[model samples]
Target: MFYLGIDVAKAKLDCYLLTQLEPLKGKAKVVTNTTKGLADLLIWLTKNHIPHDQLHVTLEATGVYHELAATQLHDAGVCVSIANPAQIKHFGQGLAVRTKTAGVDSQVLARYCAMIKPAAWTPPPPEARILKGFLARREAILQDLLREQNRQEKAESTVTPELIHQSINDSITFLNAQLKKLQSQIDDHIDRHPGLKNDLD
Candidate 1:
């Protein structure tokens, strides 16, 4: 099987197409990180004479940056694996990859895929993805609330201005409202998805 290693970033993807592992033969190409770009990547594979079934695409789990590529590639019948950041780091280290450029990262990932053949990734259900997004936003709101609370406490200890206190209180109030709304949404979502609730429970 051929391996395609992609170093995903916010704006673009650095792809390394591995033809062989021994002696390490690969060709690098970059594409925009968008729906059109993913389609273009498919055409690139065709031009390179690589079929989808024979292709094993591996990419790092770079927050939501890698999601589109992973989901699209999986849907396009290409074998896709999402490697954890830690796994990629350690694996690159094992291969003695010193340079930290995007190109080098793609090459290392290509090598890792060819050698290790990690497990394939199944895209999460839509409900799960939605819930994850909600939870992530909730966490951010909670962090904002905590920071505001901390600031208020610190300001109280100091001879801070009344306006600063008001500002802090306002932020805390907004964050609390957001958190409450998000929690309610989460609960409503759980009620809507019995299977998800069962799995979580």
Candidate 2:
């Protein structure tokens, strides 16, 4: 069996492949958090003759960055595990990894996967996924709003414009609407899943 480890980031992923008694092989892959990237990875795996069942993929949970890839891989019958970042960090610390680079990090991750042998963990169901999305979107919108407000406040009285204010208002309204929609979806999903609903309550 081959162990695959991923160091996930917002725009890219560092991938490592490890087989017993062999040095880890690393690849730096651009991931747009989209289906295309997932498909490309699947094709690469197929070309390498790595069966989905034989390949164990592990990635640290870096917020929503890992969600899309995990979802696609799970749907494709790949064994995917999400590791806690803190645990991975502590593990890496014990390795005495002095040099840090994307490739090095990837190799470290692969070794960690092999040593830890974490159980497969799928992406959360639709309800939790939506909630995660909403939380991320809400954070982004809040940051943008804060930045814009700060810019407006810093501007000279003569330079501040009504249009900027109007644009900010519009963006806030749109974001709020999207957040509300996501919350509603989460609520509906939780209601349907009695266990989840009880847990939430």
lDDT of 2 by residue, 67-175 (tens): 8888888889888888888887788789877787766766777787778888888667776666556566767766776776666566535566888767766776776
Tell me the tens digit of each residue's lDDT in model 1 across 66-133: 99999999999999999998999999998888889999999989998998999999998889989888
Question: Worst 10-residue stretch by lDDT in candidate 2?
Answer: 21-30
Residue 168 of candidate 2: its Cα lDDT? Answer: 62
Query: Which candidate leads the pack in TM-score?
Result: 1
Candidate 2 residue spans exceeding 4 A from truth: 20-33, 134-196
CA lDDT of each candidate?
0.93, 0.74
How close to the true structure is residue 20 of candidate 2, measured as C-alpha lDDT? 57
Specify the highest-lDDT model's number. Answer: 1
Q: Candidate 2 has what TM-score? A: 0.69
